[model samples]
Target: METNEVFEKVKGLFVEDLGIDESKVTMDAKLEEDLEIDSLGIVEVVMAFEDEFDIEIDDEELADVSTVGQAVNLLHSKI
Candidate 1:
């Protein structure tokens, strides 16, 4: 999928699953700062991503992804 498609899919997932506000979910949004996603939430996000994209992301690589754009970029690179 394209980057915008990925962003929209993940954004919906975050809103439906995490109860994140739509206005707060932006491309530059920081997972911790904007979404208030804690450690467990991070894990859940990763899991949701894996399920959404049908790809696996190692735990080590999770730290490198801190923004919505980063997640889209990473997903783009992988899938």
Candidate 2:
């Protein structure tokens, strides 16, 4: 999938998993500060991404994914 499409799907996961407003889950949004996603929340998001993309995300990569755009780009590369 394209990066933009992956971004939108990740945004949906943020909404579903975190109860975040869809409007606020933009590409540049910081997962922790903007979306209030804690470490556990990050784990949940990673798991959701793994399921959605059918790819495994390692801990080091997950640590580096601090922004929505980063997640999009990472998923894009994997896809």
Model 1 error, position 76 (Å):
1.2
Window of ten residues with lowest summed lDDT in model 2: 10-19
On a 0 to 100 scale, what is the lDDT of residue 12 in model 1? 96
> Candidate 2's residue-wise lDDT over 1-79, tens digit each?
7777888788878788768898888889998998888988887888888998899989988768888888899899998
Assess every candidate by TM-score.
0.93, 0.91
lDDT of 1 at 31: 92
**Residue pairs in candidate 1 whose N, alpha carbon or C atoms collide under 3 angstroms:** none
Error of 2 at 15 (Å): 1.5
Cα-based lDDT for every prediction = 0.90, 0.85
Backbone clashes counted, model 2: 0
Q: After superposition, how far is residue 27 of candidate 1 from its true place, in Å?
A: 0.4
RMSD, model 1, all Cα superposed?
0.9
